[model samples]
Target: MIVSNVSFGCTKANSAWCVSSKDGHLEAAANRSLSPTGHLIVAVCLGFIGTLGFSNNLLVLALFCRFKVLRSPINLLLVNISVSDLLVCVVGTPFSFAASTQGRWLIGKTGCVWYGFINSCLGTVSLISLAVLSYERYCTMMGTTEADATNYKKIAMGILLSWGYSLLWTLPPLFGWSSYGPEGPGTTCSVNWYAKDANNISYIVCLFIFCLVIPFLVICYCYGKLLYAVKQVSGVNTGMGRTREQRVLLMVVTMVICFLLCWLPYGIVALLATFGKPGLITPEASIIPSLLAKTSTVVNPIIYIFMNKQFYRCFQTFVRCPNPSFTSSFRSTSKTTKPGQKSRKVETNNISIAVASMGRPSTFIQNRTNSNGEQGLSVKGSKPVVSLVAHYNG
Candidate 1:
């Protein structure tokens, strides 16, 4: 049996997405729709998500650009993530918002394909960039030597690899390994998970394994080790060090959980459409995961602002005063050493307070004097990260 909502053609086999020929018959290419109330709700929600994501991420980028202190190599990876999310706000969400407001797929087939491809590309960039950022953080946490924080070349290479890797996975869909079509209430589009043919199923499987699984594993592995490593810090046995380590552990966990909570539902639902029988996911239910995934753009910057000492300080300073030189004054002193030098000690200052917040070891403890009258923190090996940490400690 079939039900009609005006021109919509709904069948029991795939009741969630009703076919509608009124919008130039393009929705017949596999788009679907929602009731008027549902469309209004989605439109309002998209407006909020899009506006907040765009504005917050824009502020983050502005803070980065305004402060030379925030230009460290590690922060570059963070900036890359913000860039990807910001692009999604500008390019991907608007079309869906328009479609939802108008109660149909407004841009037709070509627009649907573009929307799916661009969203996939940008989303993958954010995912892989997070993994890379975690790996870099691990390297920074493990030692102040190789993979040091000031290595611009390495950071640039990681940025390139993220975008290149995303293109590698997303472009194939354009060439017909799989395809793009509407999903969930027909106001948006993505890789056509509903198709049961070998081509579509195989593409979805490969995409699931390579694009989603591997990057998320990399993130979990890096951050998991970070949690363990934080506990093992030389200072963690001490009261202050232990407190700082616990804080770091909480931040690492928060980041991992946010990524999992945001994308996992969408991933699960997409797989259900790929493998389960049609209508296994209702259009209303399907939109929940989509909304959850989009919320990631909003969540990430919030985490950075509230949880990261460096980012928080920078953000605070940026808010209070927008001058670059004023921001640089907090971070301009060079704290590095020439290669082959033994551990040197420096007196703790306002600049050194960030070391404790950054989860540096007991050797790098801050805000108090060490055994020697002159020494506040002891660093064994000399690398560019010493300078970077000096800035980060700001």
Candidate 2:
């Protein structure tokens, strides 16, 4: 009565295998495929975002590898995000662009499965990393013990757990909790939200709860606590401490804002399609949220890496002089200079001129010259001495 791989005709239109129809009978229907000319604008936009994401993540990785100043525990979490973004750019974005441009699944069924798996894996990894970063920031601000701020063990554990959680959630579809297939104009592949059966419904609910809802709640809670902590510090008369706290607050706000803007729409659309009728979200309308999610990979480096003063300095040094060794030499010479104007006046003057040319004061050190001609670079008494050698890889 019903069979797959059935021969209806000699042409390509009759080549599809039988699938379960809405009426519970096996029926043969031609796969719905789109044309290249239909979504040319969408294809171009995806291609542009893909290229930009690749470039931005590459720079983030380069900055992490090149500057020892950026190798802190918190920054390692950022690096984890960058790595995930890089994978998305290389493995998922290219295929997405290609498929969009061709207006069909050009790589066949195998490619579609791989595409869905990689995109799901890397996207989950990025979200988990964001949650970890938020928790780290919270602990730093609210911990009673001083050692909690510098705990390397916590950093290592966070990295492990973030990656493990992502793998745990994303690998289920491959193992058959649900399934991956083409979606939205027949070019892109993802978890089939339209599948309304028991197993598929359970998987979609769990995936949304664990990967999206839980992490979103955790991030919100941590940042909310952090905000309260900052507000409590306002009554204290420490101007410098308040400024530092405010800057950190701003960074965290940006991170959360970007994360919500990119993923929230996609999550809402998926949820609607999963619970409501499959016709709730049309293929053409789905393109906006998919493209929005992809743009997150590009926006991350701008907020996480480029906003930092240390990264800006390191990148500037790298562009002007490609040699890391030379950069180290410059750092060492600046640090070892004697605190007197008689022997180091020329050097001190040169340093001032350089800082002026850059149009920003050095954050690590300040120049102080006494009337008796004693000169040195130093920070405030409460601030720890940031040694150039300590931050240099070599």
Candidate 3:
């Protein structure tokens, strides 16, 4: 008979707690002493929240890319950030949640290796992307117009370096330089951070420095410079419309705040897990903290789309067609021909053509004469030019 395994280790070895011999070789049931209900609840909540953040960011990225007007360098980087976060949420979080729940890995050796590799790689990439964005904003606010050809090339190189850095941390396990295996209470997979091996400790330390500390320092420095630049430019109107520099400053501040909030815990935990003595903190506590660290991926998109007005407007335009009333009103206001000059149907068709070529010189209007027999001069003695420029660049 199959019996619960918990009783087998007792001094009086209860038979009811022991499985029958015919059931084959039995490993002891993993300890559930630390599997508190509250921990599970938190894990599930984080997983759901992370998933929502991931989905929102993905939607924003997709909308931005689909519209030509939204394709700026800043938005392009934001898309990269969102895609990284999406992978973390869509690919990483579920494994994390499962590890939290079962407290032991249900998936075996190969799954553990893959999950750990992806989790580390995505986390590294997200951190680097955040740093890149922070630096970009800092440069833009400082009026540093140096981001021309050389800067773009550098940015591209930086992206490649970030991936290479991530792979550097993630690939060693495949070669056995470091180990990734199931943690106690087998629901999650991670680097064997607490292993007694000196190589593991060295690898963990290197990962923390390259992946976390250095990036954090770069982001902090860039954002600090950005804040100083914003203050310096406080009085100067950049003439880019009513949206003040303060608004962009606020966005940057908000992004930095969220990044710190979401990531600080994970960084602390990793530091402690790597250098501190084992048994100081249980694996259960680390599980939630680890999940929290990865939540930044999903959170980045929400911050950009919801907090920035320009991004929101571009997002709306990209996702939905222009309002019918607005389109019609625009056509009427820009129409070139007199309303009574032609049949209603012909007038309508002409209006469409006029709207289509609103700013360009066209053959249809080349021979048209003004009341003074000049080439359609306005009262100011200039051509009655029609200008229609749509400004949707984010």
Highest TM-score: give the candidate number. Answer: 1
> Which candidate tops lDDT?
1
**Which sections of candidate 2 miss by over 4 Å?**
1-19, 22-38, 144-151, 238-246, 321-394
TM for candidate 3 is 0.68
- Residues 288-392 of candidate 1 have per-residue lDDT tens digits of 888888888899888755465566667787678647775454454313322222222333443422231122111333344556765344333211221123322
Q: Model 3 off-target regions past 4 Å? A: 1-29, 32-39, 98-103, 143-154, 183-185, 237-249, 318-394
Taken over the whole model, the C-alpha lDDT of each candidate is 0.68, 0.64, 0.54
Per-residue lDDT tens digits of candidate 2, residues 268-377? 88877778754556666676788899998999888877886656667788678657786775576334432221101113433321110010112234567878888755
- TM-score rank, highest first? 1, 2, 3
Models, CA RMSD each: 7.5, 10.0, 13.6
Models sorted by lDDT, best on top: 1, 2, 3
Q: Provide the lowest-lDDT 10-residue window in model 3.
A: 354-363
lDDT of 3 by residue, 1-394 (tens): 0112222333132111222333221334344223558447746776786678677877877777665434444556667777777887787677657655654344545776687778778877878877876666555434343223113455566577667777887889778776665433335556765454577668777877877778888888876775554443332223321233456566667877787777777767666755666444464666566656666665777776556544565565556787987545434432433222211111221221111111111113223466786542112111111111111222
How many residue pairs clash per model?
1, 0, 9
